[model samples]
Target: MFEAMIDPTAGPSATAAGPPRAGRPERLDGLVVGLVANPKKNAEPFLDAVGELLAAEHGTAGVVRTRKTSITDPIPPATLDELVRRCDVVLIGVGDCGSCSAAAVADGIAFEGAGVPAAVICTDAFRVSADAMARLQGSPGYAYVTTAHPLAPLDADAVRERARLALPELVELLTSAVPVAAR
Candidate 1:
């Protein structure tokens, strides 16, 4: 008998036609940012820290957010629409484990499909996994930022530290290479 193994964590994936990669918005100056909280325990706080950094350092205008009730569930269409409508760019948080990482990258692809610039956050250990997900989703070489691993197990201070360390890359991904016209 042969037993085949499958990645139990794989969820829905994205297709190549889903979205064309758009250039970044020209400036964070007065740009509204959408922060996606994937309902992982520490994701919200970590994302919040990143948002704060953006606000202080990049002069971002505002941040809107949505928290998924579960990591495995798809982000509601309404939530995606809201973020797309109100925000110039989006920052999705904490693609830590397998399924969550895949889901987060999928969400990033979805935003890209909507013509929004998005960056998914993954822990250092899962960076490879998240990139693989991006490739599988048809948005190979997709943008994402990496924080230290095991966010759920961290204290607030530790989480903040990781977020702080990740802030530069986060800004780099969000602001770099954006078309001036898109701003």
Candidate 2:
């Protein structure tokens, strides 16, 4: 019975072809930031704080917030299209668990493929799952931000602190123009 169990993370038999990663912008000034949040505990507040920081310090024009239907599901194509059309750069996150980490990474890849720079935030503990999902999505070595582990247990203030700590990497991911090969 134990041998019959399959390891889903063993690696995909064939990687799905994803879109070309979008080029990063030189700056965030007057750019519209998009925030995609899963329904996990503290995810929204964390994103809210990040959005606030971007608006206050980065000269972002505004923010558009959206919620995913489930942590394990991908963002619908239509919603992804809408975000690509409306946002200059997008931030997605709160991937504190395995499934959600994969999903969040997938979401970030999707946004990048659609020609929007995306920053994915996940807990450091789930970095393996996130990296696996990136490879499964044909985006191996995709860059994302990681906060301290056990993010779901954090209170509002704690979550905000994590967001603040994560802000620098998030900004770099969104604004740096490193070639995809280097990522």
Candidate 3:
């Protein structure tokens, strides 16, 4: 008797449709939520509030938050690795300015490639930049939520308001694969 075999490495169908994604869990309940913030003004406070809400509404187990050293740079590899290791889903925030938003999108791409789910948050002012970064990363229409523009100068209460206004969008991005909205 003879048997025939085929190599597993042969076709387009064998490849993934898009960038790698950490498997999305069925429930956010009791999952450790991570927040990675760009260190632009007001960025930390905004993420802190968002963390509070995620815990309140999502049954999140715990929060782990960190910030990139600069707004326009990729997070250090060590930090990125730690985030992937420690959290179930990461909410990335305050891609508020041009360079900063681009950097956030880039980080999102990297996180996806590393098998960690990440939601990129940018302000309306830099949607174009975020879109461009997504294209550069080969997920051109990747969806990210937009808050009102000019996040840097807002006071704590105003930033909290913006964070509040952005919660629904945040939840949507965190839960689903949204296509880029028409500008």
Best by TM-score: 2
**Model 1 over residues 5-103: C-alpha lDDT tens digits?**
223245334435447865686678799999999878899999899889889988999899789776755577899998999999998978878768767
The predicted structure with the larger lDDT, 2 or 3, is 2
- What lDDT score is found at residue 165 in candidate 2? 90
* Residue-level lDDT tens digits of model 2 in 120-180: 9889889888888888777788888888889888888898899999898889888887733
Which regions of candidate 2 are displaced past 4 Å?
Answer: 1-15, 179-183
TM-score of every prediction relative to native = 0.85, 0.89, 0.84
Worst 10-residue lDDT window, candidate 1: 1-10
| Candidate 3 positional error at 68, Å | 0.7
Candidate 1: where is the Cα deviation over 4 Å?
A: 1-15, 178-183
Model 3's C-alpha root-mean-square deviation from the true structure amounts to 10.5
**Pairs with backbone N, CA or C atoms under 3 Å apart (clashes), candidate 2:** none
RMSD of each: 5.8, 4.5, 10.5
Candidate 3: regions farther than 4 A off: 1-18, 177-183
* lDDT, candidate 3, at 77: 85
lDDT of 2 at 100: 86
Model 1 residue 64 lDDT score? 95
